[model samples]
Target: MAASGQRRPYPQLADSPSTASLLQSTETNHRSPEAAFAQGPRYSNTQSFTSSGSTSWNGSPTNQGVLDRRSYQTNSVSEKFSLPADPAVWGSNVSPDFQEPDDWIHNPDPKRDRKSDRGGSIVSYRGLTNLGCLVVLVVGLLALFAGYPIIHYFTTNQLSNLGGFNLGGINASGQVPEMIGNYGLIDADTPSSAHTYKSFADGSEWQLVFSDEFETPGRTFWPGDDPYWEAVDLHYWQTNDLEWYSPQAIVTKDGSLEITMSEKEINNLNYMSGALTTWNKFCFTGGMILVNVSLPGSSSVSGMWPAVWTMGNLGRMGYGASLDGLWPYVYDSCDVGTVANQTYNGGPAAALSGGDPSNGGALSYLEGQRLSRCTCPGESHPGPYHSDGTFVGRSAPEIDLFEAQVSGGVDSAGLSQSAQWAPMNHEYIWDNTTGNFDIADSSVTQLNSYAGGVYQQATSAVTKANPDCFDQNTGCYEVYGYEYQPGYKNQSGYISWVANGDVAWTLDAGGMVADPETEINDRPIPQEPMYIIANLAMSENFVTVDVANLVFPTTMRIDWVRVYQPKNAVNIGCDPKDYPTAAYIQQYADAYNNPNLTTWTGDTSAGGYGQTEPKNSFLGQC
Candidate 1:
C-alpha cells in the first residue's frame, strides 16, 4: 500500500526583495501551499511528510501508480481541491471555531488623520465674524461723535473783540435834553407895549408900566414930529391897514402863545413887533432862561435879529439913561471902530450917507456942529437923522424881547439912573448921594468931574461922500466903524464888541456884557449873578418902508438859549449818584457776556473766537 500524505512544490509569490525576505523569515510560522497540495503519499523520493499515524505503500510500478492516484484524490478532495478557500483565510489542522485576533478586533490606534482634525468647527467661524462686526461698529460711532462741532465753527462772521452792550465805557442816558419854545404875539393895530405884561402871566410874576408910547420929536412922516420920537417910532407901530386888526398877533392856544408874521406884512414894516423887560420889572439872580423858536419854512439865510441881552442902569437920558459908556453901547451895535476916533472935526461924525440932495439931501444929516469946530466942552453930541429915500426897504429886522435880571442891591423900581438920548450930544451921570441919574450940570466950566465929562453921542454927518462905505439904507451907523456881517437869513444873527460899563468889558456877539460894578456898588465888581436885557430899536435913519408892513404878523424864533459858567464856578458838591443802576448795568452785561447763544460759534461771537462760556479755555483766559 502507498502512503496518503505527500508534499508538492508550490510556485513562489511575486514580491519585492524586502517583502520576500520577510515572508521567508516567517515561513515556519505560515502554512506552505505545496504541502497542502500533495495528498496521496506521505513520503516519496523527493518529498516527505510527518503525521501521528501513517500508512506505508510497497509496490512495483502498477502499485505505485495506484497509490499516486489515490493520494491525488485525497489531496484534491480533503485539502486543496475540496473547496476554493479564500486567500485571506487559513485552514486549521483540526477544524475548531475560527476566531479573529485581539489586535484586529481592537481599533487601530485611531488612524490620526491630521488634515481632517485641522479643519475648525462652525462655532469658531461664527465667533470670528462677530468680532469683525464689533470692530466696525466701534469705528463708525467714534467718527460720528467727533465730526459735528467742527463744521459749525466756520460759517459765521462774528468779531472777537466787541463783546458787550457798553460802548467802550460810555453809557447812554435814555432821556433827551430839554428845549424851550417861543411865547409872544404880534399886532400892528394894538399898542407897541400891548404885549407887555399887565400882570406877568407867561411864567413870570410882574406888571409892565410904560412911561410913554412910540413917539419922535422934530420928525416928518413918523408918528411924532419931534426927531427924538423917531427912536420909538422906528420900531413896530400901530397901522390902520385892514389886516392890522386880525387876531393872528395875539392867539393863545394849547399851553403856548403863537405869534405869526407874514412875509408881506414884515416886508412893508421897518421893524418887527416885540417886547422888552428890565431888572426894573423883575429880578432873577443865577438861574438860566431858555427860549425856543422855530423858523418859518427854510428861511435860515434871512436876517433874523431876535436877541436876549443885558445892560446897566447907571445914567439917565430918556430910555437912553441906561447908556453909560462907549464900550457896551458901541459893542452891542456890532461896530468895531474906536469911540476915540469917531469924532468928526470936534463932534461925533455920522456913519452913513447918500440920499436926497436938497437941503444937503443925503440918507441922514446932523444939525449938531462938527466935533472939530464945536465949542461945546463935552466929548459927544446927538444928531442921527434919516430921510424916507434912505429907508432900508424889503430888509426885514425882527427882535423878540429885552429880558433883564439884576444882581446889585438897587431895586428895579428904585433905579437911580437910566439911559436917554438927545437931538445932539450930551453927557449924563449918576449921583450916589442923591441916588438919581441926571445930565452933567451945564453950569460946570471944566469937564473933569465924573458928572461933567462927555459920555454918549449920535452924529448924522454920513452922506453921499461914501454911500457904499456906510449902511445908508439902515439908519443905524457903525458906532465903532465895524461893518455888519450878515448871518443865516431866517436864523438869529449876532453883532459883538468891547465896552465899558462900571469897568472895561467885552460884549459877546449875542450882546452879553459883564458889569463888575453891578455886584456891589462900593466894590464895583461883578456879582455871582448879573442882569440881562434885549430890545429892538428903529431910529431915524434906520427905518426902511419896503418891509415895514411885514414887521406885523411877523415872528421871531429862538432855537435855544444857554449860559456857560466859568470853570471855577461849576458846582463841585454834585455827585455821580445820578448814574445808571446795577440792574441796568446787568442787562447790558448779559448781552456782552453771551453774544454767541443766538448764532453759530463764529457768527455771534465778538472778537475772533467762538462764543464760549465763562469757563471755556480760549475766551476765559482772555
Candidate 2:
C-alpha cells in the first residue's frame, strides 16, 4: 500500500477482538456449504500447518502460499494456526469436506466438513483441545451466529482497514473474511491504490498467470511457446483489401507496444501493416483479458482497419468437422477504425448507394428489414434478429469493445461510435451458432452506453440485460467486460472478460456476437479453446470509404495486456440459476475451493432451447 501512495493503517491491538472471541466465531461458523462442486478429481490436501500458543504462524508449515484450512485455537498450545494474511494463504483454501481424502484408514476424519450444499465454502475448522480453550472458542462462535449483522456491517461499510486492505481477515471479527482488494478478488493489496495490480475487474481474487506489460520492449513475449505471435504476413489476405503484414510492422518501443498502419511498397505491392496472434501456444479459455490501448492519436490512416480480436476453434478437431463447419468465432474484439453497427447499421453503407447496409443514409431491403429469427426453411444464411429481450442464454460472437469510424465524428460516448452514427456504437448479437452459418440470431444491443440505466451482464445472458458500470471505476481509462460459454453455459463451461473494471462482453459456450446463436441448452457451442489476434488491417470489410486521413501514419498504442483466472482453479462448471442466484458470481468463486470438480449443466441451444424447449424456444422448431 505504501508503494501506491496509500499506507496500511497501524493495527490497534487494544481494539482487536479477544483471542477467545475469534475461536468461538470459528466454531459457530463451521456450517458447511450447500453442496461441494468439486473442482478436480481428488484434492491433494497438500496444505499443512501447525499452531502453538496464541499466534498464527508457528511451526514449519510449507510456504507454498497455502493457508491452514483448520481453525486457529488459543488453548491448543504446540498447535500452529495459519492465518489468512497473504494472497497465497488465501489461495490455499478448500471447501470443508464430507468425504475423507482419496486415501484413509477407516473412520471419517474428525476435521472433515459435510455441511456444504451450495455457495462457496472457503475455510474449515477441526482441531480444538481442552475445556478452557473450547470455552473461549465458543465466545467467538456466538459472535458469528448472533452478532453476524453487526460484524458484517462494520467489515463491509466501515473503513478499508477493517478488512486489512479489505482483503485480509485477521482483525476484530477474526472470521474468514472475504478478500476484496482488487476487483473484489482476494487481493493482498487495494488494487485501485496500487499500479502494480493489473486490470482484474471481476470482484473475485485472481492469480495473474499471463501478462505482457511490454516492460522489456523487444523481448520475446511467450518464450518456449509457439513464439510471441504468429505473424499474418500476406498481401490481399482473406479480406480482399490492401496491405501486407510484416514483422517490421510490429514493434515494442518506448513504454508501450505499437502496431502501426502505414503505406509500404513491398514485393511489387503497395499497402502494408502488421498482424500477430498467440495461436495454440498461449490460447486461454476464460480470464480477465485487457489491453490498455489508446486508439491512433490521429486518424491519418482512415483507410486502415485495425482490430484487437479473438477467434474460436470450432473446427480444431478437423477443418469444418468439429461442429460440421463452424470455423470463425469473434469471441470479443475491437476495431478502432471503420465498421457499421450490426443492428442500426450506419456510416458509408447509407451513403454511396447503400454503401453501408446498416446506416440509414441509403437503407437497403436487408438493412431496413428486422426479423425475429434467422434461417427459415430454405434460407441458409441468418437474417436480421433482435435480442430475446430476456437474455435467456443469448450471447454475441463479436463483442466489439471499441470500434470507431475515424471519419472523425462519433464521440467517446459510444467509445467514439455512439448510436447517432448508426453501425458505429458498441454492438453484440448472436450471428451464426448453427445450420447454414447464415446469421442465425440477432439479439443485438449497444453495451457502451447506459441506455436508460442498464449495462450488459458478465455472468449469464439469461439474467438482466442492463447493469451499471459507471461507478465501477473512477479514471479516464476505459472499462469493458464480457463472458464466453461452452456448449451448455451451466455444464460445458464459461469464461469471463473484464476490462477497466467492467464487463466488456461474454461469449457463453463458445458463442460470439455477429456469429451464430449458440447456447448451453441447445445449439452448437464451441468446445475448444480460442486464440487472440491483434492486427492492423486495411478497410473494415463492412464498409468501403476510409475512416482516417489517407496520407498519414496512424498507430494503435497498447500499454499492456493482462490475463487472469481464479486462483488455484481452472474453468469450474456450475448451474448459477439454482443454488445461488443466477447472477451472483460467488458460486463461481467456489470453483477455486474445489479444483477440477465441476458437475452441473442444463442444456445448450442444440438439444434444448429452440431444439426441444417449446415455450423457451426462440427459433422456430428444431
Best by TM-score: 2
Q: Weakest 10 consecutive residues, lDDT, candidate 2? A: 451-460
Writing each residue's lDDT as its tens digit, candidate 2 over 88-114 gives 433333545544345445655455345
Q: How do the residues 497-563 of candidate 1 rate in per-residue lDDT, one tens digit apiece? A: 1111010111112221221221101111111112233332222222222332223334433322222
What Cα-based lDDT does every candidate model obtain?
Answer: 0.24, 0.35
Give lDDT: candidate 2, residue 549. 36
Shift in Å, residue 100, candidate 1: 99
Off by over 4 Å in 2: 1-202, 220-226, 297-302, 313-324, 329-404, 410-501, 504-521, 524-526, 571-622
lDDT of residue 550 for candidate 2: 57
Task: Name the runs in model 1 displaced over 4 angstroms.
Answer: 1-272, 278-291, 296-305, 313-318, 324-530, 533-552, 558-562, 570-622
Score residue 288 of candidate 1 by CA lDDT: 24
Candidate 1: Cα lDDT at 292: 30
